[model samples]
Target: MSAFWRDSLAGLCALLIGIGIARFGYTPLIPVLIQHHWLDAGDAAYLGATNLAGYVGGSLLAAWLSRLVPVARLTRIAMIITTISLAACMLPWGFLWFAPWRFLTGFTGGLLMVAAVPLMLSRAPPHLHGRSNGIVFTGVGIGVIASGTLVPALASEGPAAIWGGMALVAGLLTLLTWPRWTPQPGDASPGTRGTTRAFTRPVAILLVAYMLDSAAFVPHTVFWADFIARGLHRGIEAGGFYWIFFGVGAMCGPVLAGFVAERFGFYRSVTGGYGIKAAFVALPILSQHPVALAASAVVVGAMTPGISALASGRVAELVGFAAHRQVWGWLTGGFAVASAVAGYLMSYLFDSYGSYYMLFGIGTVGLCIAMLLSVFVRNPPAPAAQAA
Candidate 1:
């Protein structure tokens, strides 16, 4: 097979193990953990925050290491670490162990995302970059679907069994991609920073918008399952069902975003996406009817990865490909910080007020602000001109 297919496959597997299983696996398992008395609501929030914090750390490290390590090696290491961390969560050692393990898993996710996303995009021919990114990120949805469907059934088996199962899946994916990760020749010099442009107004605006978009997603990613299962007194199975729809939306989000962005431009596509997402974010607050909630899941799920794919495309459009590796790291790190902050804040709100209304309200406001900011993002010059 061609290098393009191999790289894309490797990236998909990396994301599945990293973001899907390591970073997001915990969210679906929240209801199970709480029910099993393995963790309290507050502890769940703390664990989530800890994981995001580790993501921040790992992202920054990836940025610094981009010039030092090959993407293939970085990805391989991250996948292995993510697998180990997932297995570690299955240990009966309690929160002390769980916190570190979760953090480690998220750290690996951060590394994999920063390294693999741009790597995959860079490997694809320019015309296919947007779709390639969307395809790679689909792993997140696949992971979510697995967790949403598989974890609920495993809930009766206990946390150890559930976590162990996740580790096994991640390990298998890691092995599948392992042989193909041999270093590429001329994989860009480690230190070849993009001199095409510096951080300008548009880049700054895009980063802030991306950051807010990240924050806006916290309510759903961290708390949606818990909210349904615990907040609405819906059974875990119902919550899982909702989460499955969420994953389904995510699975398709990138492809839709890619098509729209290619036609309408990334700026318009992102603005419209955020607008739709913001509306859905407010849905549960207005009405928790099963239909409204389900719609909310589908819309929000689509936008989560959709926005990500669009944002990266926009970044590449603005900064040029040579700069993508470094810039992508900062963008992802900013998102991680936002996610961490939102996780802690929402966790506190849940503990103090026992409601998600305020969280969704805040998220809606943030998304609106992001949409407004996106309007200012002008299309950059053609890639050849930008690279020149």
Candidate 2:
């Protein structure tokens, strides 16, 4: 009914289903797939790598295609394609079929992500940006949390049956959202040609920072469970609990970021956020206490997502919002490529070393670097000050 409520609900739905298919759907189904003897651990790991590679490729495709297609239509198509592709995970009897489906899911997911994430940032009023992103991005955490709860319960039902159910759910959400997709505000903003100077410096800096942040996060998400099991001397239950906390913390992050940044400066908050995460990530290697490990994980997850919220909002502030989706898409696609390669490299390092210490060390360096880079970021002077 109200604009705020309407916008929030609509944006939240898009993020929930789109990212649900791209990231969270496969994990819960893994146990079911494992139970069915459909995929081995190595097969699953490689498939995950393949899926991220596809994510990079898809982001590039979306950027190229963004210039040709209107942003909303492109996004609608991406979500629909992703919803269909997610069901592809069920098609395979083994890794053979599952792999490409995962790839396709990654592809559609990346396209929709760039389309969805930046637009949501730009459309919400300035004050609401952090809270809005927090609410919408919580969809990934919700989907992941749901997967953890649902998959084990459905383990007996098998992959095909579970896939059928999820596909139906996604289909319904997409149908519900078809008529209500919000108008992208680029039409109201100045066109980009006169704004080329606005984009060059900030975009260059954010692009690099995003890439480093991506590399930094890969280890935590990809190997947090392993780090606990090997270094912390914990079993699957402990690992599971740790990941759930991280997910819940991440889900709550946007709200916390918005609140804290409102009081403290955004740049200062982000630097501190990155610094805190780096410390938390390195904590397990320093000591193996279960409670300490879990606490660190919560901090790591909570602080990291908010860093992105702060960073993306900074871009919109610095760059101006004309065809913002296209600009951010180009920027995001670059970061996705880095993210994909960085993720693959992180996994490769873990396998080669048979330890997580090096991985954590690399992540620490990345955050420190990003924090140092933040110094170059300054808000443009007021319009009158520049005129003077």
Candidate 3:
């Protein structure tokens, strides 16, 4: 394959290896575990929650440690731990064994995201920020799909077999693509003194907005299959299959964002994105048709990338290279904590109420907050004047 393919493939692998545990591995595997009597509902919920905590902790470290550790090294370190921790999956199946590794996996995944996202964007010519980051962010959806699809396919096997197979696949991919990766210029770690605070008002708002988005988004993700299967009375396989549409919807989000931002101002582009996504959050409850699900997903997915790209590009614009890495770390770390909390809350609601309605409610509220947040973030004043 050409360098472009390698670079793309490598970036894709970073996401796959990163969230393979929290997003993909655990959900499908939980069913398998229950069958084996390896885990109870509480065990899985607690473990997934711990994974979120670890992710936040990792992102927090990335935010500050980048001052001393270079963004590339941080990503590389994350990749290494991600690979190693995944290998640990094949080791055993105790609740204690899996939970800590899962948490570590989340931690490393956050670190990788902090670096990989901007590095990929920087590889593009300056203005292609929308396209590069969009593609990278889309990988989150693809990774989500892969996790669900791959886990169920392996579900017939023993839990060990499933985890072992995924670990081998993820670990090999990481090893093969190591050399192809490079950090963006100025993304390198500086000495401790360089870790100055950069919490502009916009940054604070971005952080809060991202956290709310995460809290709202996690429920749909963590329990989508269960909702479809149990709530809608679809079979488990059918429900899981529906999530395929969700992934497709999400994957399209960034591609459309690229086109949208080109046509509209970045701020408007994001506002539109959040607006569509908010509608889609309540869509399943409203339309309730399999076809509507697909349509809703595509439209919702298409809008998200614009907002995310707009957010990142705005950060790069506001803070300049002097502190982009640090700022992103803070914003994304807040997102990680909110996501973890949201996931846990959703699980609690499911086990409590036996419905996905609450998940939809959470999504609705979150997207609305995200929309309001977008309005507050106007164009960063022209760089020349803002730099002072």
Candidate 4:
């Protein structure tokens, strides 16, 4: 295969191990942990939040560390750390013991997410940027699909078995992608840094909207499987099936959103994506009918990554390419902070109320606010206007 494909595959593997397995692989296992008495419902919820918290640190760390370390080297080390964290979780020593390992997984995952895509994109030919991104982010969906399908099958064998299986998969991906990572000449140079004041009115509006999107999606990402399995009494198999639908939608979301953005423009596409996601996220609260649940699963899943792509493009449209990386880093950092906060807050509310309905309601409201905020985001001034 060509170098482009090699880099894309390696990036894909990094994401698959990082966000896919490290972050999301734990979702389906939430029900299993509670069911097996390895952890209570509240502890499981908190553990999930812990990973999100670790992700916040990792995302911030990746930005600073990239200046000091080669992006490819950092990504490789992250994957290795993520694999180790997965293996470490198999010990089954309880919540305190498992929390740190889960945190490590999230940290490494954040590092991969922030570092891996750029590493691949830097090597990609200009014409192939879009296609290469699709290939790389597709790893997230593949990882979700693997976890959603495999966890239930392994659940019968016990949680340790599930952890072992995930570790094994992560280990194989690490080995396969290891040598494919090559450093770019620019990797050694510390690039220009932009100020936070780049958050002009339009950019600030967009950033807030993006942060709300992060907060709104927490319900599905953190609690969907548990809601289906425990909340509805549907069992782990049923939960996994819906999660499979989510995975399928996730796989299609970014590509479909990219096409829509190219046609309709990123601004309108983001607004519509948020509106649609809000409606679907609230669907479970309105009705638990099998069809309603499936639609919710699919649409919300699609919007999760779909909206992200649109928002990133929207950022570029607002700030131009030179500042896009810096602005986008702020955007990403905001997202991680929101997700971490929402995850913990929702977990607390769930523990206090013992209901998933409130969580979905909160997500819906946040997205609705985001949709409104997105409507106010105007485009950047023309070059001539800026110069004047």
Candidate 5:
């Protein structure tokens, strides 16, 4: 394979294992935990909150660690830790054990999220950066599909087996990408030390939009499967079934976003993505029709990572290659912090209200704000200058 494809594949696998399995695999398991009487709804929410908090830590750590260690080495270490954390969930430990393990998993996922894109983009040519980001984010959808479909099927074998199965998948992915984790001599090009400079208007707007997107995503990312299972009176399997649509949407979303970015510009593509996401966020609340919800799942799933891919590409476009890692890290860190806050807040709302309406309603508002914020983002330099 060419170096670009090799790097992209490795990055994709890294995200599939780290963010997909280690971080998001927990979403499908929440209903199972309740079904088995292993955790109540409140406890499940707390676990999600704790994991998001860890994600915040991991994002910041990746930024700081980038200065001290090679990003390639940090990514490899993060992937290994993420695998171990996923497997650790299989232990017969109580909620106390699960909480810490979940936190660790999120932390490792954060590291990979911040590090992996730079690793992949480092190998691509300038013009391919937009498409490269879309390709890398596709791994998250693949991982979501695995957890949403495979985990529920494995639920009959009990939590231990389900956890172990997910871990085994992560382990296998780890092995596949292990050799490529080592940094090639030119991977971290000279002058790529990310700047600590003040943000320009475009970067600032992008940051706010990213933060809003993070918050807007909480309801679906953490609770959609549960809503289908409990709120809609569908069985756990049915919830997982809907999540399959979500995965399918996500799988195709980034590619579409990349195509739009190539034509209309990344900033415009992301703005359009958030606008579409807002409508989908309100769909399940509007009707219980299976088709409507399925359509909602597909659109929301597409916009989730679709926005991320385009936004990250926009950041690189505004800041230049040298600052890509730093700017991306800051953007991701802000997003993670917002997600952690939203996770806990949504948990409280859920526990208090016992309904998904409020949760998704809030998400709709957040996405609208994100869409408006995204509209403010412009190319920091002239198109020709940015291209050069």
Candidate 6:
């Protein structure tokens, strides 16, 4: 195969192991953990938050670590650690024991999330950048599908089986993609640097909106499966069934967003996406009908990754390519921090009230604010040289 396809495939596997299985694989297992008495509902929620906390650490460290180690080497190490963390969970050593492992999983996932895409994108021809990105991110959706479908099937064998199965999948992916991380020349050098001037008013507004998206996403990402399974009194299988719709929407989201952005521009696409996301996120509060729930699952799932794509493009549009990386790093770090905070806060609220409705309501409100913020982000003025 050509280098583009080969590298894209490797990137896809990286995200599949990192973000897909390492980060999101815990959602479906939440209900399982509670059901098996491994952890009570509150503790289980707290454990999930721990992973997000680790993700914040990992995102903060990934760039600095990449400066010390090769990006490819650091990414491979992260993937290996993620696999080990998953396998370690099979011990059933209790919440304290499991919490650190989950944290490690999230940390490694953050490393991969930060390092893998750029590694692949740098190698990809400019003409193929869009397609390559879509291919890579599709791994996350595929991983979600696997979690929803495979986890339930494995849960029948017990929680240990679920952990082991996920670990096995991560391990297989690690091995399969191991050769692809061969370091190229200049792999050790810190990449292009963006000046502080890149932080313009429009960029700040966009950053805040992006951060809000992170907070808004916490409910669906952390608690959707548990809400359906335990909150609604549906079985794990039923929860998994709806989660599959989520996965399907996630799989399609990036491409759909790209298509819309191509026609309407990234700014408008992002604004409209937030509006649509707000409405769907509020759906569960209005009606628990199967169809409404399914629509909610699909639309919210789509916007999870969809908004990321739109926001990334918007950043590039606002700052130009030279500053895109640095500004985007700010955006990502803000997102990680916000997501961690929201995850813990929502977990606590769930523990206190035992209601998913309030959590969904919070997400909807956040998205509405995000949409309004996005609407105020006017395009930056043209550079004098370009205008001349």
Candidate 3: C-alpha RMSD after superposition: 3.3
Model 4 TM: 0.96
Q: In model 1, where do residues sit more than 4 Å from their true spots?
A: 189-197, 379-388
Q: What is the descending lDDT order? A: 6, 4, 5, 1, 3, 2
- lDDT agreement of model 1 with the native: 0.83
* Tens digit per residue, CA lDDT, model 5, 1-388: 8877878888888888877777777888889888887788899988998999999998888766766788888887888787788888787667798898889888888888887667777778877776677778899889889888887799898888888898889888888888878877777622334354526777888898889989998998899999999988888898888888888888888899878888998777888888889999998888989999999999998888888888877877787755766777788899999999999999999999998989999999998998898777765756424643
lDDT by residue for model 3 (191-281), tens: 2323354666766776787677667666555656556655576755655576666666666666676676678866676666676777877
Residue 152 shift from truth in candidate 4, angstroms: 0.6
**Preferred candidate (lDDT higher): 1 or 2:** 1
Clashing pairs for model 6 are: none
Model 4: per-residue Cα lDDT over 239-320, one tens digit each: 9889988887887888888889989998899999999999999999999999999999988888887787788788778877
Report the C-alpha lDDT of model 6 over 107-151, residue by residue, as the tens digit.
888787777677887788889888887888888888999888887
Clashes of 3: 3
Tell me which of candidates 3 and 6 scores higher on TM-score: 6
Q: How does each model score on lDDT?
A: 0.83, 0.65, 0.67, 0.86, 0.83, 0.86
Q: What clash pairs does model 5 have? A: none
Residues 358-386 of candidate 2: C-alpha lDDT, one tens digit per residue: 88889888878877776676553343124
Which candidate leads the pack in lDDT?
A: 6
Greater-lDDT candidate between 2 and 5: 5
TM-score between candidate 1 and the true structure:
0.94
